[model samples]
Target: MEAEFKDAEIFKRMMDATGNLMSDVSIDFNEEGFAIKAMDPANIAMVLFEAKNSIFSSFNIEKPIKISVSLDDLNGILKLVKKDDKLKISDSKNKLVLDIRGKTKQHFTIPLIDENYTAQKIPQLKFTAEVTVLSSLVKDSVKAAALVDDSIYFTVDMPRLIISSKSEEKEFSQDLSINDNKEIFDMKSESTTRSKYSIEYLTKFLYSADSEKPIKLSFSNNYPLKLDYEINSDAKMSFILANRLE
Candidate 1:
């Protein structure tokens, strides 16, 4: 099978995001697109990523295939790809050939791993509150929490959407208008809803939020949080992070 991509940056961003969570990954490539669902080693967070055929400028598939690859190895090969390079991927019996073409063509072959792990099942969750906030705001809040501790708490106090973190030395809180759905967020929470999560996972998750589009977060009291953002046309990413309970 062969697949060509005009935009490697999107794939790069996605691979980077997935690599932060797991060293190896299974990418199921169908005629429509590629789908991935994986849980971190600690099982505290799950990632679901999909990119449709329409998202690619050019797509040619001989057949549907499940390709398992080492993210570390893929990253090494991707480091050599230039900004305007067009990427082509061809599959052999046990190797995936990656070629980047621009001024000159660079070819790198990666050995595909055997598909041995079972796929993860995404669960249906009912959340009491959901909010869409600016990606920058989320980054700022996470950074603030990083300064204090490794964990942060998110709470919905009606109009105020709050994020707080405390350490041995200091505590930080950021409050944004939940009513301003256009900018801050659109939220629904009657009670003082709260959930705590690890800042480490959050920081890696937010690393993929390079766009200005608002990030959607949904959760309930002490329940797992679901976060989602659009990567581009026909491509989107969603994450479920288990809440930290004391």
Candidate 2:
């Protein structure tokens, strides 16, 4: 089996984001496309990544396969990728081969892990509130919260959404409303809902998002936070973060 991605940058970004939470990952490659599902070491967060065959420039596979790899090793090579570099992936004996094409052709092989891959079951969550806002706003909110505490609170009161953090001596807040904040495209809430989540996981999730694009947030009072980002028409990433209960 062999596959060629349309944009090496996109592939690199995807791996970089996932690596923030997980060091080892199993990638499932099939006729349709490829998918990756992983949970953070502490099990506080989970990430789901999927890319359709359409997202790849060329994909040739006779059968479905799952290859486990070390993100550190893979990312080490990807970090050297130039702007115009192209990437093709294939499998060799107990190893994953990376063929990078650019000014010169290069091949790098990394050992594949020998282990059984178990699929993680995504929690079925029902959210009372949903909001679509510019990704940059969410990223900034997380950054601000990091200065005060390790966790942040997300509150929704009708048309308004508030991101805040508090500690013994520090407090920070950023407010947005559908009617007033131009960056907030839409917001809906059944009632006043609030939840707290770890800022570290939030930052990792936002790393995969395009700051200029929009991201959807779903949550309920003291429930898990569901953040959805669309990389393109054929690719998507979703994150579920368990609430940091007080």
Candidate 3:
């Protein structure tokens, strides 16, 4: 089997996103494309990734396969690819090979990591509130929260999305009003919802995404927060973060 990515940057972004939460991942390659569903070692955060076959310039497969590899290993090679380089990938008994071709050529191989854990199945959660806002908005909020504490409180209402954090030393909070910014494209709620999450994990996800892209968020009081973003034209990635229990 051989696969080619027209834009290596997209694959790099996906790796960056997963690497933030996990060191190793079991990636499934099928006719549909590539998908990964994994939980952080601490089981505090879950990440789901899906990139459709259409997104790749060329994708060929005889049968579906699952490969375990270190996110750091793949990211390392992708970082070396030139802006216009097309990425070609292959796998063998115990290693994955990457060929980066553009004005110049580069080749690298990484030993596959052995994975013993099974992929997790995420449930369909019903959230009381939902909102779509620019990724930069939440990214900035997390940055502010990090200055004060390790966790941030997300308070979502019909008219606003509030982020707050406090520690013994200082407190910080930011209210993102719904009506003012066009970046807040859509919002709906039967009632208000609030939850606290680790700013560290939230920043991991945010930093991997495009600042201008829209992020759809869903949550309920004291429940896990869900964040979704379009990885590309045909791919989408989501994260489910366990709420901080006080």
Candidate 4:
């Protein structure tokens, strides 16, 4: 397996997303694309990473391979690469090679692979409404809600979207409306659906956005929320954050 990236920062960002809730991940590299899936120990959240040929500057895999690795170790190794240096990874048996151009190459030996766990398939969520919103606005809502409680309430009404959280001592709410031009696209709400989710998990998901690019949100009452961040024109990365009702 050989892959190259022009900037190491992009690689760091992808690894950071996995480190939030997952310690280890099962990554599959095939002709179709690259995919990673891992569940938190408590089973409350799941993080997914995906990058396709269109997203990467250069993506080439002679054969498919699946490996389970400690995310922290990978991140640590990736950090060694300088800003402009290219990064490459190749696996053989129990050893992994980390190559940094214009610098000393490093080979890190990890534990033997354990192929015992099964990959959980993300369910096809049937959402009543889907909305497209700016990443910054979503990040702000999560940050504001974090001050009061660990959970946030997401409420979407056509032409307006609201994220609110309250505790016995304090309350906070963020409202984005079509009239204000903050919300880029608002879909008609089929039914008034509200659900509570962990602020930490939602915040991590928000960071997956590359820029002010639109994120697709799908949700149902008391059901898991799906947030998708499109990487390049052809690739997308998503997170399935479970709900904790208020």
C-alpha RMSD for every candidate? 1.8, 1.3, 1.4, 2.3
What value of lDDT does candidate 1 attain over all alpha carbons?
0.86
lDDT of each residue in 1-246, candidate 4, tens digit only? 766665556657777777776777677878766787767777877767777655445667888988777877887777677766777666767755567775665555565367555777776778876778877778877888899998998887766777899999999998777778655566556877777888988887776676577887888888888888766555567788888966
Best by TM-score: 2
Per-residue lDDT of candidate 3, residues 160-220 (tens digit):
8788999999999887778876778888888778888898888887877889889998888
Point out where model 2 deviates above 4 Å: none
The TM-score values for the models, in the order shown, are: 0.93, 0.96, 0.95, 0.88
| Model 4: CA > 4 A from native | 55-60, 103-112
Report lDDT per candidate.
0.86, 0.90, 0.86, 0.74
Cα deviation at 39, candidate 3, in Å, is 0.8
Once fitted onto the true fold, the runs of candidate 1 whose alpha carbons sit more than 4 angstroms away are 179-182
Assess the local accuracy of residue 17 in candidate 3 as a C-alpha lDDT between 0 and 100: 83
- The TM-score of candidate 2 is 0.96
Q: Which lDDT tens digits does candidate 1 get at residues 73-159?
A: 998887777898898887888998999898999888989997766889899999987878888888988988899999999998888
Worst 10 residues of 2 by lDDT: 114-123
Highest-lDDT candidate: 2
